[model samples]
Target: MGVSGCGKSTVGEELAKQLGVPFAEGDKLHPASNVKKMAAGTPLNDDDRWPWLDLVGADLRKGYEADGIVISCSALKKIYRERLRESCGGPLAFVYLEGSVDLLTERMGARTGHFMPLSLLQNQLATMEVPTGEPGVVTVNIDASPEEIVANALKGLASL
Candidate 1:
């Protein structure tokens, strides 16, 4: 749970595979209007994110009986994470794929076929609250390979 280019989706998919759990891409749950706005290079506001966050949270909650599940979401604000927690009606383990603005911009620019633009990186970082002291949150620095990051996250989750 970091900015636009923080490798949330990539790491999430691998982590889910490692854990043998279902993986959900939170971006795909966004409303059409939100996608359109992002596709047009506009950063989304809180009003536009709450509904999408709720959907993602519900999806996460739906698999509570399973062994586990992994999902990629840019839960930028503390309130956003709280809202997700409320919707899930249970605990959640969040893995934050954090990186610097330069790295994020490079990653965003290298990627393609995505609605989130590099122009939105600064806005996302500005909105991010860093999740410090949040229960069940593991912050992983994005300075290594995806495999290494996933390994680190799995180890962190073990401690949680």
Candidate 2:
């Protein structure tokens, strides 16, 4: 998990396909109010995020009980990750998609139809607590092509 435009959905979907597991877009689980807030270019506070994180974690747990699942979540803070872990009540692996601000902004600018605006990218980056040294997390650089990024993620996850 990483900031917006870090390609979490793209990578997570490919990773799930490769692993023969279900894939869920965490953004889709967001409450309408949360979406409305973000769509209005307002950054969400922790209060707005906890319930959404719980929903994401619950979905992860459901897929875990079946055949494992890959989900794309911002998971921007250590506390947020912990919450997800608690809710999942099982193993959770995060593929942190790392990229430069310019790269991220460029990608965000190029995308459309997403509720998250490019204006919020800075806020997300500022709020993020990078998952470095965190257990069950793999840091994958996003400067490379999606195929390469996914390949590197697979390699890192294998070692995890």
Highest lDDT: give the candidate number.
2
Task: Indicate the worst ten consecutive residues by lDDT in candidate 2.
Answer: 83-92
**What ranges in model 2 sit over 4 Å off?**
none
Distance (Å) between predicted and true CA of 105, model 1? 0.9
Whole-model alpha-carbon lDDT for candidate 1: 0.89
Best by TM-score: 2
In candidate 2, what are the lDDT values of residues 15-54, reduced to their tens digit? 9999999899999999999999999999999999999999
Taking all chains together, each candidate's TM-score versus the true structure is 0.96, 0.98
CA error at residue 149 for candidate 1, angstroms: 0.4
Candidate 2 local accuracy as lDDT?
0.95
Q: Name every residue pair that clashes in candidate 1.
A: none
Candidate 1 residues 92-133, lDDT tens each? 889988887888889999999998878888888888999979
